[model samples]
Target: MSLHDPAQLMDERRRLEGLGLSVTRYGGAIGLIGLVLACLMGFIQENGMDRFFFVYLTNFIFFLSISLGALCFTGIQHVTRAGWSIVVRRLMELLAANVVLMAILFIPIIFGLHSLYHWTHAEAVAHDPILQHKAPYLNTAFFLFRAVIFFAVWIGLALFFLRKSTEQDESGDYKISIRLEKVSSWGLFLYAMTTTYASFDWLMSLDPHWYSTIYGVYFFAGSAVALFATLSALCIGLQKSGRLTRAITTEHYHDLGKFLFAFTIFWAYIAFSQYMLYWYANKPETTGWILRRQTAPMLWVSLSLIFCHFFLPFFGLLSRHIKRNKSLLFFWAIWMLVMHWVDIYWLVMPEYVHQYGEIGAAPFGLMDIFCLIGFGGLYAAGFAMWARGRSLIPMKDPRLAESLTFENA
Candidate 1:
């Protein structure tokens, strides 16, 4: 039963495998069905088929953000060799593994380029002098090429770190840890540049005419918030399953709560700063985008975000006691996740429906569910499989002992 004994860990792995098989079977089925329903609904709605392409593209990018953010978190922990996060790092690795699934999901985005992005229309691009000027860089051929490079780099780095960490667990090798640290240091820098540009290429290009220099940062901040929320929820769920009962304690939950609170504020700050600069400058192009969001249903959703995403969580999580309480933190984490989804919906839905006078829930349909389920089910299934035979903690980490005994000062 010694923590460091490889044999004891193997026994634990068998228990985990049994747990995973049952969870994956039930959870995967429900998730797949829900997603299929969303996709079907999308197909049924008027213009739903066309809009489905955009929705799918958006979901794919959102999933990519989660996967990449997980990769970033894992890299950061290695580079810093932070001890406090050892227990939760496995969750991040599992999430990062989903990057491969996201890459496959991106194919729809490529095929639907003409439907989703204005720049993809040759006739439209030819008439617009500005778009024409950017054509060399914005062309479909270049776009696909860039996407492949981005995913290849991301997948390679994620797998490299993950494999090294897992191998080190069995062999008790410190060199693997050191090697990963070196890789992660460089990986972090590359991630920053790639994610920013990827956001510009995928989301920002929806409105080719309107541009924001800070758009990438805006997306980056949101991604971080979403990732933290996701981690908190995942940890809480794992605890509920009776695993990690000893390893993930109130102290860990407390720190996770603090992270969630900090990122929630960061997301709001970045969002507000972006809006304020554009609004104050009064540039026609910049203000026009805000104007579209300010009217009708988008406006209400924007205001709801002010409360649900920030103000509610800000006040709710302010108490030290709240952060230390599992149930309370879980509730806040789930709430924040919902708000993040709404935030993304607000960001994307406007681009497609802005031409219409005001926004309305067009209809609930299949495409939405299909894309979400198709992607989400695969993500969950992969995460479960990844979790099956590994110590949830990095057992051989030089810092594992420190992490097991860690206390916040």
Candidate 2:
């Protein structure tokens, strides 16, 4: 009955694979088709290509945060010697691997720098005193160099942890556990630094003239929320496919829901804190950023986020029954995912297109859907590939038995 029995664990994994493969394959195919259609739409629509380019770049940056957040989760599980999560950590590892795909997607962003980022243009920078001062740090060369370093650090950490975990799966050596613990302890620190800086470079810099000390933390909060929502959805979908039925229980769903709930609050707090501080100070520079968002149609989008992203989820997930109920949880998870996209859209689009009369639906074009589909498809494909031919759970973990028997107090 010991969960660490290699023979039994392998047998269970084989059984789960047979059940899960068809669903996973179907999902991946649908995702691929959606992406292709989106791309075509982008090309067909007038001025769509430019909009698509921006959407693509933004989604690419957003995926980078998700991928890196997954890396952070994987490292934390190892460092904490968390057994309950051992069953799910491999899923995270695979998601982390999508960081490579995200890095590849960054090419469009690099090429479209002039279009997506105003500060990237010499004419724009020269006219603005603030941008001119920031030119040294915000120039194309430094931007590219920082991006390369960010990916190098992220990919290095993901591969190292994944490699070590796979090696331990084969050898079943205790020493490998110790090594992972050591690596993840330091790796978490690096993750925090890298993700914060990446957020600053990719997102915060969109408004180069404006700055917030709390912007990085705000990004982290949103990233964690988005990632938790993704994990919950994935787990629920896998379970419905009749995989991980026994390995992952309602308790796991409950725990995931709690994290999602906590991060939702954190995201709201950071967002409000950032806004409140700027509003109270009433400084021209800080208020200018808010001014762009608070007027016209963008104002409605901001209000929608308050309701969809914070208020709705805040109360919707409060019930224990809802969190543990597979169907309800799945619905909420999908809702949160959509809201996160809107949140990002609100954050980046207003700044990029503020001159277009404050939102007015911001011209919901094919490019947005195409970029999302393309990036999401690639991410799903990478995850599926990583999940293939591996034990979904770390069966050899010393605490596997404890995890299987875990229950909420």
lDDT, candidate 2, equals 0.77
Residue 195 accuracy (lDDT) in model 2: 83
lDDT of 1 by residue, 95-189 (tens): 88778777877876777788778888899987999999889888899989989888888888888877888887778788887898899899899
**Considering only N, C-alpha and C atoms within 3 Å, which residue pairs clash in candidate 2?**
none
For 1-409, candidate 2 gives per-residue lDDT tens digits of 2243334454453234554465367656766676567667767877655566557656776676677768988898888888777767777887888787778777767776776677887888778998988888899999899889888888998988777777767777878878989999988998888888887888778788789989888888878888888899988877666666677778888888988888899999999999999999999988988887787667888898899999999999989899988888888888988888888777788776752232455556655775677667667766776667776666566666667766789
